[model samples]
Target: MTDSSNRRRLRVGGLPQVLLQWGFGGLAALVLFLMMLLTFVDVIGRYLLNAPVTGSFEIIELMVAALVFCALPLVTAREEHVTVDLFSHLLSARTEQTRAVVVGLLNAIILTAMAV
Candidate 1:
């Protein structure tokens, strides 16, 4: 596909789209920063002060979950999710497009179910 077409696939319009992108992006960045800070403090406390941060593992686990959830909307908006792409060479252009549409619909249905 052309570059513009590829971009159009990820393009969202209107104010809500802008809000969703920025909100999720900001949340993910904040969570990542906090995760890094926590890890640094935990390491320093363990080695230098002989007092590791309490419940660091649980905190990290929850932060990671938050991070993923916060980032998922942006990732979906960008259509950047992981895929195998192993059959790209074998499929014709039309078949590939059809496959992509089918997969996209399936993803929408699954996500809608999860939301409900």
Candidate 2:
């Protein structure tokens, strides 16, 4: 628990990583903004004009998926995923380390398969 360790790391992946994260992060933000706008328009049209936006549901569905994917890199880079450590007290340190390695391998395999 040194002061240096407590500080944030520059592992944001240098220039390339920074560009990538900014790009994807911006895209995710744009998609989210569009979704909000779409929802607002749809609501206004549905309630005030008596005409809902056409294909709004489908558009929102697709946008939701895109948003998730666009934000994936950031999530992976920051390791901001959910953790359910229900049995953490029962597991030894080595066991926890082993489980992490196994999960990482499985994740890599799955992601590779999906990419292909």
Candidate 3:
């Protein structure tokens, strides 16, 4: 092979993507860890010390919500969400892309309605 043909274009899938994915995972793990630790502390304080961690319930609820919200984009980007695949395999590639775009538009409309 000639050197010109052997030269591959530089790809942008190295440390950046790895760091982004890992950062998201780390955030999720940190939230989970904090939740568990807070719960444990709350339990210990209530049962052993006769005093609960103040606002522990609210804090955990907020943390859980934040974790889920933060994970949504990552999940969508990864295509790890459950999807109805009925007729998807039968569709041509172009048709599938069109369907996906239309579905996305519909989702946006529904979301906008709900928001309003």
Q: What tens digits encode model 1's per-residue C-alpha lDDT throughout 1-116?
A: 46786456546466777777778889999999999999999999999999999999999999998997888767776777898988798999999999989988988888777657
Candidate 3 at residue 85, lDDT? 89
The lDDT for every candidate, in the order shown, is 0.85, 0.81, 0.75
The candidate scoring highest on lDDT is 1
Q: Residue 53 deviation, candidate 2, in Å?
A: 1.0
The order of the candidates by lDDT, greatest first, is: 1, 2, 3
Off by over 4 Å in 1: 1-12, 109-116
Question: Which portions of model 3 miss their true places by more than 4 Å?
Answer: 1-12, 87-92, 104-116
| Clash list (residue pairs), candidate 2 | none
> What is the per-residue lDDT of model 3 for residues 1-116, given as tens digits with 9 covering 90 to 100?
23443222112345665567678878988999999999999999999999999999999999997787567546644545678888999999999999989877886686457446
After best superposition, candidate 1 residue 30: deviation in angstroms?
A: 0.2
TM-score of each: 0.78, 0.81, 0.67
- How much lDDT does candidate 3 score? 0.75
Clashing residue pairs in candidate 1 are none
lDDT score, candidate 1, position 84: 90
